[model samples]
Target: MKTILVTGSTGQLGNELLQLSHLEKDYRFEFVDRSQLNLASEESVRDFFTNKTSSDYLSIINAAAYTAVDLAEKDKHSAELVNVDGPRNLAQYAKSIGAKLIHVSTDFVFDGNHSRPYNETDLKNPISVYGKTKSDGEDSVLEVNPDSIILRTSWVYSQFGKNFFNTIARLSKEKESLRVVADQIGSPTWAGDLARVCFSAAISDQSGIFHFSNEGVASWYDFAYEIVRAFGYHCEVIPIATEEYPTDAKRPAYSVLNKQKFRKTFEVQNVHWKERLYRLVEEVKGQKLT
Candidate 1:
C-alpha cells in the first residue's frame, strides 16, 4: 500500500481527508496536525521527514497554510514563514526522497481582473499579502521540484470547520437579516470534493499547476441565499457591495477557476457547488454551535 503523509491534518480539508482514511485497504495515510509538525520551522519540518519510517511509495500532501487574509496583511513575515517557506522545505524534502509533493493553494493568487474564468496559464498578479505569500509558495514548490503539483482552490467551505456556509446557517437561524457581498464572484468549493481530487492527484499525476473547485459561479450573496433556501430557512439575505463592507485585505471580484485541465488530466468530474452544499447542511444539521 502507498504511504501518504498529510500535513495540517486538523484543517477543514484535512479533516475531510481523514474521514476517507477509514477504509484504508488500498493506502496508508499518516496525519500530522500543527501540534505534531510545525511546517513554519525548517528544523521541525526536517524533523518530521527524518523520523518517517514508512517508505512505501511516499507522497506528502501539504494542506497546511497561513490563511488569515486580514491578519496576513499585518503579519506578513509569519504568513511567508508558513505559506512560502513551509512548502519550500517540504518540496526540498520530497525531492530528496523522490516523493510526490502535492501542495494546496488559494485562488487569491490571481488579481481578479479577468472577465472570464481563469485558466491554468493565466498570469498571476496577487494584490494582497496572503495571495502574495501563497503565490511565492507556488513558485518555491515548482522551482525546487518540477514533479510537484500545485492545486489552487477558491471560496472553500465545509461542514467540519469555520466556513461561510456554516456561518450563514448559524446567523440565519439567529438573526432576521444577513448581509453578504454581491460584487465578489467565484466558485464555492466544498473541501470534501477537493480532498478526493487531492488524493487522486497524489497517486496519478505528473507535475504542474491545476485549478480545482466545484463547478458553476456565484457571488457571496448568491451563495448565502442558496444555503438558506436549500435548508428551508426564512432569512433575508441582503446584497451589499464590497465598498460598503470593507476588509483589511482586498478580495478578488472574480476568481472563478476553470477546472478543464484538471478534469482532462485526472478524469475526475467536479460536482456543482450547490450539490455539495446540500450534503454539508445535512451532515451538520444536528451539531451544536458555540
Candidate 2:
C-alpha cells in the first residue's frame, strides 16, 4: 500500500481525515501531530522524513497551520513560521522525495472586496497577518514544487476543535442573548467535507490552486442563529455589523469562494451548507443524549 504522511493529525481537518482513512484501504497513512513532526522547525521536518519513516511516502498532506486570526497580529513571527516557512520546507522535501504535497490554505488570502464569489484566478490582497502569511505559504509551496496542490477553503468548523458551531452551542446553554457579526459573509465549510476533498486532491494528478466550501452564503449571525436553533436553545441571536465588533485582525467583509473549479476538476458533489450543518448538529445532539 502507498504511504501518505498527514501533518497536524490532531487538528479539525486532520482528525476528520483520520476518521475517514479506514474507508480508503489502498493507501496507508502515517498521522503525525506537532510532537511527531514539527513543521515550524526545519530541522525537525528534515529529520522526520529522513529517519522517522522507513519507506518513502506517496504524498504529504500539510494540514498544520497557525490558525489564530487575532493572535496572529501580536504573534506575527510564530504565524509566519508555521504558515509560510513550514510549508516551504514541506514542499522542498516533497520535491526531493518525488512525493505529491497537498497544502491547505484559507479564503482570507483574498481582500474580500469583490462583489461576487472569488475564483482561483482572482488577485490576492491579504489585509491581515494571517492572511498574508497563508498567501505567502501558497506561493512558497508552488515555487518549491510546481506539482503541489494548494486547496483554499473558508469558515472551516468541526466537532473536534474550538469552532463557531461549538462555541455558539456552549454560549446558548450559558447565555440568554448572543450577538454575532452579520456584515461579514462567507460559506461555513464542514471539516469532514474538506478533508475528503484534500484526500481526493492527494490522489489525483491535478496540480494547481482550487477553492472548496459548502454551497451557499451566510453571515456570522445567520450561522449563530442556525446553531442555536438546531440545539433547541432559546438564546436571542442579534445580528450586528462588522464595525460593531472590533478585532485585532481585519477580516474580509466578503470571502465566499466559488466552487465551480473544484467541482469541475474533482467531479465531487458539493453539499449545501445548511444540510451539512443540520446533520452535524443532530449528530452532536445525539452524542450528548447518549
Candidate 3:
C-alpha cells in the first residue's frame, strides 16, 4: 500500500479526508496536525520530512492553513507564516524527495472581478491579507515543484469543522433573524467533495492548478437561508448588501470559479451546492454530537 502524509488532520477538510480511510483502502494514511508538525519552522518541517523519508512516504496533502479570513488582516505575519512559509518548506521538501504535493488554496486570490466564473488562467489580484498569503503559498509550491497540484476552492463548509454552514446552523437557534451579505456570490463547496477531489487528483495524471467547488453560485444570504431550512427552523434570513455588513477586507462581488480544467483533467465532477448542503446536514444529524 502506498503511504501518504496528510497535514492539518484536525481541519474541516482533513477531518473529512480521515473518514474516507475505509473508502480508500489502496492508500495507507498517516495524519498530522500542528502539534505533530509545524510548517512555519523550517527545522521542524525539515525534521518531519527527514523522519517521513525514513519511512519512504511518497506524497503529501497539505490541508493545514491559517484560515481566519477576517482576523488575517490583523494577524498578517501569522497568516504569511502558515500560509506562505509553511508551504514553501513543504514544497522544497517534496521536491527533494521527488514526492507529489497537493496544496489546497482559496478563490479569494481573484478579487471577484470577472462577470463569469474564474478559470485557472485568470489573473490573481488578492485584496485581503488572507488571500495574498494564500496566493503567495501557491506561487511558492509551484516554484519549488512544478509537478505540484494546487486546488483553489471557495466558501468551504463541512459538518466537522468551524465553517459557515454549522455557524449559521448554530446562530439561527439563538437569533430570530440573521443578516448575511448578498452581494458576494460563489460556490459553497463541501469539504468532503474537495477532499475526494484532492485524493483523486493526487493519484491521477493531473498536476497543476485546479479549481474545485460545488456547482452553482450563491451569496452568504442564500447559503444561510438554505441552512436554516435544513435545520427545520423558521428564522428569517435577511439579505444585506456588502456595505451594510462591512469588514476590513474588500471581498469580491463575484468569485465563482470555472472548474472546466479540474473536470476535464481529473475526470472528477462536483455536485450541486444544494445537494452537498443537504447531505452535510444529514451527516450532522447522524452524529448527534454537534
Best by lDDT: 2
Task: Using lDDT as the measure, name the better of candidate 1 and candidate 2.
Answer: 2
For every model in order, what is the number of clashing pairs?
0, 0, 0
lDDT of 1 by residue, 116-227 (tens): 9999889999999999999999999999988999999999888777778888988998888998999999999998889988889888756899999999999999999999
Cα deviation in Å at residue 207, candidate 2? 0.3
RMSD of each: 1.4, 1.8, 1.4
lDDT of 2 by residue, 1-290 (tens): 88888999999999999988988999998899999888888999899778433256888899999999999999999999999999999998888888899999999999999979999999999999999999999999999999999999999998887888878888888899998999999999999999899989988999999999999999999999998888899999999988898999999999999888887889677788989999988888855321
| Candidate 3 worst ten-residue window by lDDT | 281-290
Alpha-carbon lDDT, every model: 0.89, 0.91, 0.88
Kindly list the per-residue Cα lDDT of model 3 for residues 47-85, writing each as its tens digit. 877755524666789999999989999999999999999
Residue 2's lDDT within candidate 2 is 87
Q: What is the descending lDDT order?
A: 2, 1, 3
Residue pair clashes in candidate 1: none
**What TM-score would each prediction reach against the true structure?**
0.96, 0.97, 0.96
Candidate 3 wrongly placed segments (more than 4 Å): 51-55, 286-290
